[model samples]
Target: MYTANNIADFFLGRYAAEGKITPMKLIKLVYIAHGWYLGLTGKALIDENPEAWKYGPVIPSVYHSYKHFKNSPIRCEHDSEVTTGSEIIDKFLDRIWKVYGKYTGTQLSAKTHMPGTPWDITWNDLKDRNRSSLQILETDIKEHYQQLASKNANG
Candidate 1:
Protein backbone atom coordinates (compact mmCIF):
# COMPACT_ATOMS: atom_id res chain seq x y z
CA MET A 1 0.00 0.00 0.00
CA TYR A 2 1.07 3.56 -0.60
CA THR A 3 0.65 6.67 1.47
CA ALA A 4 -2.37 8.69 0.44
CA ASN A 5 -0.02 11.46 -0.64
CA ASN A 6 1.88 9.03 -2.81
CA ILE A 7 -1.35 8.15 -4.57
CA ALA A 8 -2.24 11.81 -4.67
CA ASP A 9 1.13 12.55 -6.21
CA PHE A 10 0.60 9.86 -8.80
CA PHE A 11 -2.76 11.26 -9.78
CA LEU A 12 -1.44 14.80 -9.79
CA GLY A 13 1.42 13.79 -12.02
CA ARG A 14 -0.51 11.72 -14.51
CA TYR A 15 -4.09 12.93 -14.60
CA ALA A 16 -4.09 16.55 -13.43
CA ALA A 17 -1.60 17.84 -15.95
CA GLU A 18 -4.18 19.67 -18.02
CA GLY A 19 -7.09 19.17 -15.69
CA LYS A 20 -8.37 21.11 -12.74
CA ILE A 21 -8.02 19.12 -9.55
CA THR A 22 -9.34 20.68 -6.41
CA PRO A 23 -8.56 19.27 -2.99
CA MET A 24 -12.05 17.82 -2.64
CA LYS A 25 -11.79 16.06 -5.98
CA LEU A 26 -8.35 14.67 -5.23
CA ILE A 27 -9.43 13.47 -1.79
CA LYS A 28 -12.51 11.72 -3.12
CA LEU A 29 -10.54 10.01 -5.85
CA VAL A 30 -8.08 8.63 -3.31
CA TYR A 31 -10.89 7.36 -1.11
CA ILE A 32 -12.61 5.72 -4.05
CA ALA A 33 -9.41 4.00 -5.09
CA HIS A 34 -8.96 2.70 -1.55
CA GLY A 35 -12.47 1.26 -1.46
CA TRP A 36 -12.41 -0.53 -4.81
CA TYR A 37 -8.84 -1.71 -4.43
CA LEU A 38 -9.51 -3.04 -0.97
CA GLY A 39 -12.69 -4.79 -2.07
CA LEU A 40 -11.10 -6.43 -5.07
CA THR A 41 -7.71 -7.35 -3.66
CA GLY A 42 -8.66 -7.92 -0.03
CA LYS A 43 -5.77 -5.59 0.76
CA ALA A 44 -5.45 -1.92 1.46
CA LEU A 45 -4.91 0.57 -1.32
CA ILE A 46 -3.82 3.25 1.14
CA ASP A 47 -1.93 3.21 4.40
CA GLU A 48 -4.76 4.72 6.40
CA ASN A 49 -8.50 4.63 6.87
CA PRO A 50 -10.68 7.56 5.91
CA GLU A 51 -12.68 9.57 8.37
CA ALA A 52 -16.30 10.46 7.75
CA TRP A 53 -16.40 14.23 7.50
CA LYS A 54 -19.36 16.50 6.89
CA TYR A 55 -19.03 16.44 3.10
CA GLY A 56 -17.92 12.80 2.82
CA PRO A 57 -15.06 10.46 3.52
CA VAL A 58 -11.67 12.14 3.72
CA ILE A 59 -8.09 11.10 3.81
CA PRO A 60 -6.92 13.56 6.43
CA SER A 61 -3.35 13.66 5.28
CA VAL A 62 -4.19 14.52 1.74
CA TYR A 63 -6.79 16.99 2.89
CA HIS A 64 -4.33 18.82 5.11
CA SER A 65 -1.68 18.77 2.44
CA TYR A 66 -3.96 20.42 -0.06
CA LYS A 67 -6.28 22.50 2.13
CA HIS A 68 -4.22 25.55 1.35
CA PHE A 69 -5.32 25.30 -2.24
CA LYS A 70 -8.93 25.54 -1.06
CA ASN A 71 -11.02 25.42 -4.23
CA SER A 72 -8.11 26.18 -6.50
CA PRO A 73 -6.50 23.59 -8.70
CA ILE A 74 -3.28 22.35 -7.15
CA ARG A 75 -0.29 22.15 -9.45
CA CYS A 76 1.05 18.68 -10.17
CA GLU A 77 4.05 18.14 -7.91
CA HIS A 78 5.08 14.63 -8.92
CA ASP A 79 8.11 14.19 -11.10
CA SER A 80 8.30 10.52 -11.96
CA GLU A 81 8.61 9.60 -8.34
CA VAL A 82 7.94 5.93 -7.65
CA THR A 83 4.61 5.20 -6.03
CA THR A 84 3.11 1.81 -5.11
CA GLY A 85 6.08 -0.34 -6.04
CA SER A 86 3.83 -2.80 -7.79
CA GLU A 87 2.98 -2.33 -11.46
CA ILE A 88 -0.33 -4.08 -10.92
CA ILE A 89 -1.32 -1.46 -8.39
CA ASP A 90 -0.27 1.30 -10.74
CA LYS A 91 -2.43 -0.21 -13.51
CA PHE A 92 -5.37 -0.52 -11.16
CA LEU A 93 -5.03 3.14 -10.25
CA ASP A 94 -4.87 4.00 -13.93
CA ARG A 95 -8.17 2.24 -14.37
CA ILE A 96 -9.67 4.25 -11.53
CA TRP A 97 -8.47 7.45 -13.14
CA LYS A 98 -9.93 6.38 -16.45
CA VAL A 99 -13.33 5.86 -14.88
CA TYR A 100 -13.55 8.70 -12.37
CA GLY A 101 -10.99 11.27 -13.42
CA LYS A 102 -13.58 13.36 -15.19
CA TYR A 103 -15.90 13.96 -12.26
CA THR A 104 -15.99 17.33 -10.56
CA GLY A 105 -15.45 17.51 -6.82
CA THR A 106 -19.14 17.97 -6.17
CA GLN A 107 -20.06 14.98 -8.30
CA LEU A 108 -17.63 12.71 -6.52
CA SER A 109 -18.81 14.02 -3.17
CA ALA A 110 -22.38 13.19 -4.14
CA LYS A 111 -21.36 9.68 -5.11
CA THR A 112 -19.73 9.06 -1.76
CA HIS A 113 -22.70 10.55 0.09
CA MET A 114 -25.24 8.40 -1.70
CA PRO A 115 -27.57 6.33 0.46
CA GLY A 116 -25.96 3.31 2.12
CA THR A 117 -22.46 4.47 1.26
CA PRO A 118 -19.96 3.92 4.06
CA TRP A 119 -19.61 7.64 4.76
CA ASP A 120 -23.33 8.21 4.69
CA ILE A 121 -24.05 5.40 7.10
CA THR A 122 -21.31 6.37 9.47
CA TRP A 123 -22.02 10.08 9.37
CA ASN A 124 -25.75 9.66 9.78
CA ASP A 125 -25.30 7.29 12.67
CA LEU A 126 -22.73 9.39 14.49
CA LYS A 127 -23.04 13.01 13.45
CA ASP A 128 -24.90 13.97 16.58
CA ARG A 129 -22.37 12.39 18.85
CA ASN A 130 -20.39 15.64 19.16
CA ARG A 131 -17.33 14.22 17.55
CA SER A 132 -15.30 16.11 14.98
CA SER A 133 -14.83 13.06 12.83
CA LEU A 134 -15.70 9.37 12.74
CA GLN A 135 -13.68 6.63 11.24
CA ILE A 136 -15.36 4.98 8.30
CA LEU A 137 -14.76 1.32 8.86
CA GLU A 138 -12.64 -0.46 6.31
CA THR A 139 -14.92 -3.47 6.60
CA ASP A 140 -17.94 -1.41 5.67
CA ILE A 141 -16.07 0.18 2.80
CA LYS A 142 -14.95 -3.21 1.52
CA GLU A 143 -18.45 -4.65 1.72
CA HIS A 144 -20.03 -1.70 -0.03
CA TYR A 145 -17.65 -1.86 -2.96
CA GLN A 146 -17.81 -5.63 -3.09
CA GLN A 147 -21.58 -5.44 -3.33
CA LEU A 148 -21.25 -2.76 -5.96
CA ALA A 149 -18.88 -4.94 -7.96
CA SER A 150 -21.21 -7.90 -7.61
CA LYS A 151 -24.19 -5.84 -8.71
CA ASN A 152 -22.35 -4.52 -11.76
CA ALA A 153 -21.28 -8.06 -12.63
CA ASN A 154 -24.81 -9.40 -12.27
CA GLY A 155 -26.35 -6.66 -14.33
Candidate 2:
Protein backbone atom coordinates (compact mmCIF):
# COMPACT_ATOMS: atom_id res chain seq x y z
CA MET A 1 0.00 0.00 0.00
CA TYR A 2 2.95 2.32 -0.46
CA THR A 3 1.47 5.43 -2.00
CA ALA A 4 3.08 7.75 -4.54
CA ASN A 5 2.86 10.80 -2.31
CA ASN A 6 4.31 8.86 0.61
CA ILE A 7 7.33 7.77 -1.38
CA ALA A 8 7.46 11.20 -3.02
CA ASP A 9 7.38 13.10 0.28
CA PHE A 10 10.21 10.96 1.53
CA PHE A 11 12.20 11.28 -1.66
CA LEU A 12 11.66 15.01 -1.80
CA GLY A 13 13.15 15.29 1.67
CA ARG A 14 16.12 13.11 0.76
CA TYR A 15 16.94 12.05 -2.80
CA ALA A 16 15.58 15.13 -4.52
CA ALA A 17 18.68 17.17 -5.50
CA GLU A 18 16.28 20.01 -6.29
CA GLY A 19 13.11 19.89 -4.19
CA LYS A 20 10.74 20.76 -7.03
CA ILE A 21 12.04 18.50 -9.77
CA THR A 22 12.47 15.66 -7.33
CA PRO A 23 8.80 15.47 -6.31
CA MET A 24 7.60 16.21 -9.81
CA LYS A 25 9.66 13.47 -11.38
CA LEU A 26 9.07 11.15 -8.46
CA ILE A 27 5.32 11.50 -8.85
CA LYS A 28 5.60 10.51 -12.48
CA LEU A 29 7.98 7.68 -11.67
CA VAL A 30 5.68 6.40 -8.93
CA TYR A 31 2.84 5.94 -11.36
CA ILE A 32 5.19 4.24 -13.81
CA ALA A 33 6.41 1.96 -11.06
CA HIS A 34 2.87 1.22 -9.89
CA GLY A 35 1.78 0.36 -13.38
CA TRP A 36 4.67 -2.05 -13.65
CA TYR A 37 3.82 -3.41 -10.23
CA LEU A 38 0.21 -3.93 -11.17
CA GLY A 39 1.27 -5.70 -14.29
CA LEU A 40 3.58 -8.02 -12.45
CA THR A 41 1.08 -8.65 -9.66
CA GLY A 42 -1.86 -9.01 -12.07
CA LYS A 43 -3.61 -6.11 -10.33
CA ALA A 44 -4.05 -3.66 -13.19
CA LEU A 45 -7.41 -1.94 -13.01
CA ILE A 46 -7.04 -0.59 -16.57
CA ASP A 47 -7.37 -3.81 -18.53
CA GLU A 48 -9.21 -7.05 -17.93
CA ASN A 49 -7.12 -9.93 -19.17
CA PRO A 50 -4.43 -12.33 -18.17
CA GLU A 51 -2.53 -11.35 -21.28
CA ALA A 52 -2.29 -7.91 -19.68
CA TRP A 53 0.82 -9.35 -18.07
CA LYS A 54 2.50 -9.29 -21.47
CA TYR A 55 1.69 -5.61 -22.01
CA GLY A 56 3.27 -4.69 -18.65
CA PRO A 57 6.84 -4.23 -19.96
CA VAL A 58 5.67 -1.19 -21.93
CA ILE A 59 2.10 -0.74 -23.06
CA PRO A 60 -0.28 -1.21 -20.13
CA SER A 61 1.96 0.39 -17.52
CA VAL A 62 2.49 3.61 -19.44
CA TYR A 63 -1.18 3.93 -20.31
CA HIS A 64 -2.18 3.49 -16.67
CA SER A 65 0.36 6.07 -15.58
CA TYR A 66 -0.98 8.68 -18.01
CA LYS A 67 -4.55 8.08 -16.94
CA HIS A 68 -3.70 8.95 -13.35
CA PHE A 69 -2.26 12.30 -14.41
CA LYS A 70 -5.23 13.17 -16.59
CA ASN A 71 -7.65 12.79 -13.69
CA SER A 72 -5.51 14.66 -11.20
CA PRO A 73 -6.98 17.53 -9.10
CA ILE A 74 -5.26 20.00 -11.43
CA ARG A 75 -6.92 18.63 -14.54
CA CYS A 76 -8.00 21.39 -16.88
CA GLU A 77 -11.69 21.83 -17.62
CA HIS A 78 -10.94 22.07 -21.32
CA ASP A 79 -10.67 18.49 -22.38
CA SER A 80 -9.65 18.68 -25.98
CA GLU A 81 -8.71 15.60 -27.88
CA VAL A 82 -5.77 17.69 -28.99
CA THR A 83 -3.10 18.54 -26.35
CA THR A 84 -4.71 16.00 -24.05
CA GLY A 85 -2.31 13.13 -24.53
CA SER A 86 1.37 12.90 -23.70
CA GLU A 87 1.42 16.64 -24.33
CA ILE A 88 -0.19 17.20 -20.94
CA ILE A 89 2.32 15.32 -18.84
CA ASP A 90 4.45 18.41 -18.38
CA LYS A 91 1.49 20.52 -17.34
CA PHE A 92 0.18 17.76 -15.14
CA LEU A 93 3.42 17.51 -13.22
CA ASP A 94 3.64 21.29 -12.95
CA ARG A 95 0.24 21.63 -11.29
CA ILE A 96 0.88 18.79 -8.87
CA TRP A 97 4.26 20.20 -7.87
CA LYS A 98 2.65 23.54 -7.13
CA VAL A 99 0.03 21.86 -4.99
CA TYR A 100 2.70 19.92 -3.16
CA GLY A 101 4.51 23.15 -2.41
CA LYS A 102 1.36 24.75 -1.05
CA TYR A 103 0.64 21.77 1.17
CA THR A 104 4.15 21.54 2.53
CA GLY A 105 4.72 25.31 2.85
CA THR A 106 8.07 24.77 1.27
CA GLN A 107 9.52 26.83 -1.58
CA LEU A 108 9.86 23.72 -3.65
CA SER A 109 10.04 25.47 -7.01
CA ALA A 110 12.39 28.32 -6.13
CA LYS A 111 15.35 26.61 -7.77
CA THR A 112 13.54 24.37 -10.21
CA HIS A 113 12.57 24.76 -13.83
CA MET A 114 9.30 23.96 -15.50
CA PRO A 115 8.71 21.20 -18.03
CA GLY A 116 11.62 19.70 -16.14
CA THR A 117 12.22 16.31 -17.73
CA PRO A 118 10.17 15.46 -20.71
CA TRP A 119 8.49 12.17 -20.00
CA ASP A 120 9.39 12.37 -23.66
CA ILE A 121 7.10 9.51 -24.53
CA THR A 122 4.39 8.99 -27.12
CA TRP A 123 1.21 6.89 -27.29
CA ASN A 124 3.01 4.49 -29.58
CA ASP A 125 5.08 3.56 -26.58
CA LEU A 126 1.98 2.46 -24.67
CA LYS A 127 -0.97 0.15 -25.14
CA ASP A 128 -3.63 -0.03 -27.86
CA ARG A 129 -1.17 2.17 -29.69
CA ASN A 130 -3.55 5.05 -28.93
CA ARG A 131 -2.99 8.39 -27.22
CA SER A 132 -6.17 7.97 -25.16
CA SER A 133 -4.33 5.37 -23.16
CA LEU A 134 -2.56 8.25 -21.47
CA GLN A 135 -5.63 8.69 -19.36
CA ILE A 136 -5.02 5.39 -17.64
CA LEU A 137 -1.65 6.42 -16.27
CA GLU A 138 -3.01 9.72 -15.06
CA THR A 139 -5.86 8.04 -13.22
CA ASP A 140 -3.58 5.58 -11.51
CA ILE A 141 -1.36 8.30 -10.06
CA LYS A 142 -4.29 10.30 -8.78
CA GLU A 143 -5.66 7.27 -7.04
CA HIS A 144 -2.29 6.49 -5.58
CA TYR A 145 -2.07 9.91 -3.91
CA GLN A 146 -5.63 9.71 -2.77
CA GLN A 147 -4.78 6.46 -1.09
CA LEU A 148 -1.86 8.12 0.61
CA ALA A 149 -4.07 10.86 2.00
CA SER A 150 -6.53 8.33 3.32
CA LYS A 151 -3.84 6.23 4.93
CA ASN A 152 -2.27 9.18 6.67
CA ALA A 153 -5.63 10.41 7.93
CA ASN A 154 -6.38 7.05 9.43
CA GLY A 155 -2.96 6.56 10.91
Tens-digit lDDT track of model 2 for 1-155: 44344333333433343333322344344444444345334344233211112222123333343345542332222222222123343344344445443332123222121121112122234443455434334334334435545676799
- The CA lDDT of each predicted structure is 0.89, 0.35
Best TM-score goes to which candidate? 1
Estimate the lDDT of model 1.
0.89
The superposed Cα distance between candidate 2 and the true structure at residue 79, in angstroms, equals 39
Q: Which residue segments of model 2 deviate by more than 4 Å?
A: 17-23, 44-134, 137-155
Error of 1 at 59 (Å): 0.4
TM-score of model number 2: 0.27
lDDT of 1 at 109: 97
Worst 10 residues of 2 by lDDT: 111-120
Residue range with the least summed lDDT across 10 consecutive positions in model 1? 76-85
Cα RMSD to the true fold for all candidates:
2.2, 15.4
How does each model score on TM-score? Answer: 0.92, 0.27
Model 1, residue 73: C-alpha shift (Å): 0.7
- Residue 18, model 1: Cα distance from true site in angstroms: 2.7
Residue 123 of model 1 has an lDDT of 93
